[model samples]
Target: MIHTLSISELTVSRGERLLFQGLDLRIQAGEAVVLTGANGAGKTSLLRTIAGLLRPDAGEVAFHDGDGNPLDERLARGRETHFLGHQDGLKISRTAREELGFQCDWLGHVQCGMDDAVQAFGLAPLLDLEVRRLSAGQRRRLAMGRLVGSPRALWLLDEPMAPLDARWRAVFADQMRRHLDADGLILAAVHDPLPLPARTLDLGGLT
Candidate 1:
């Protein structure tokens, strides 16, 4: 099944400051779009809006099926999308194994391909350690386990590579490519260029 995200005439504001206005974008399956801009340029805001985490001041954000029919808002945001923000969203007290179990459940999977995810992220040895004991990069890997444990149609990532070392970053880049090859959609807010081919959109001109 193919899915597409459409954003039309979108406007967003934070407090008294206006972010972007009259923005439009369309992303189809097997595609990736990278959002780029200086700090406070609303890159994260755009991603959050599309993820249904924030209300847009104007316009519409919707998902369409391969046939061009719109999907229910609930299904679009809940079942089809995965949002990974800067914060790893891990409980410091939980062991990596416990957290991964919870993440797989929360992602609506029955621990499918979980072993593969552990191997892919090199998480076998770290699984017994508490999240607080994990380094920044380790925590990031643990948090990302959901991307493999359970697959979703769309991924919204905010600086996904920021915490990783060069090697893990390369691993994640390969994962993103595989996602695209499997007809998944990605919208990422990134400072550095993504290691794969992706369309770049700069969210400039804040007022």
Candidate 2:
């Protein structure tokens, strides 16, 4: 009856090869879980599957709402969670403010105000600059800020710490910890240790 994200008997295949099979996971509120594996492992594939962007060859993923009832699948798959993939989804032509505002509107993130989002991400100085002019780390920071500004219960992050330097990495890691403290669930794929304590799911032994 508790709020949780459940994956049962998950089986995912990439073309002719089986990436993973008979996998299972359950994520409760406020928990952070990291998925660790090699390049060809099914970490990303599993994230895509859970995001409803990829279909698993078998098994199912579901989210239970606070009321102990399953959330509407349509809403859960599209809006209840934020999935940050390997590629940054940003418009090179748009300024940081413009881009973040557009994303907030697009995602219907009414609870997160524009000013609060900008300030939270320490992005005031970069607001007027076009995304194309921003450096790699700046762009990544903007993306991280955008995530903090947006409201969602679950976050699916793929290699989130890769673009960050030590300081920003710690900053974002702190943000992740804050998110978990707020009872948000996070599932990420990473090669290194997270700044905060986290439970890890290693895919090395899976056949």
Candidate 3:
């Protein structure tokens, strides 16, 4: 089922500093919204708020299915969305294979796609290496494997291309486009421009 994310009259702040107020956005299924702003402009904060990771000082974020029916709060927070933050969210002590294995299971027990994801990301060579032993780019690739291994309706990403080389960056660009083509939603905070078609939301003025 396709899902849409709606944010209305949203107000957010960081500590004593105010971020943005009265912000509103609607992301339909198969669409991508890229957050663009200078550092400390609350780009990351907005993504977190949408993901239900932070309490917005004011405003509401809601999830609705294709039929415009509101989803259960639990379902919205669980299998419906995936959030990829600045941190890779991997265990340094574990092998890359183990990390992907755990993520595949957590993302709905779709472990069968792990190998395919590894191959897609060219991660087969790094599988047996401990995560800590991998380079930053390699770790990022491993982290991104979950996006393919386990599908979700919405993806919230922050600087998803930061650590990648030009080649992999282009590779992931294609992947993002494919995700949108499959009726997936993406909201990403990015510095470099995303290769696919996307609406850009600049928080500069909102601040």
The sequence of per-residue lDDT tens digits that candidate 1 reaches over residues 1-207 is 338999999999999888889999999999999999889999889999999999999999989999999999887888888889988889999899999888877877644568867988999999999999999999999988888887888999999999999999999999999999999999999989999999999986444
In candidate 1, stretches whose alpha carbon ends up further than 4 angstroms from where it belongs are 205-207
TM-score of 3: 0.96
**lDDT, candidate 3, 92-111, per-residue tens:** 99999999999888887464
For each candidate, give its TM-score against the true structure. Answer: 0.96, 0.93, 0.96
Local distance difference test scores for all models? 0.90, 0.84, 0.90
lDDT tens digits by residue: candidate 2, 24-79: 89998899999999887988999999999999999989999777788876688677
TM-score of 1: 0.96
lDDT of 1 at 77: 85
Better of 1 and 2 by TM-score: 1
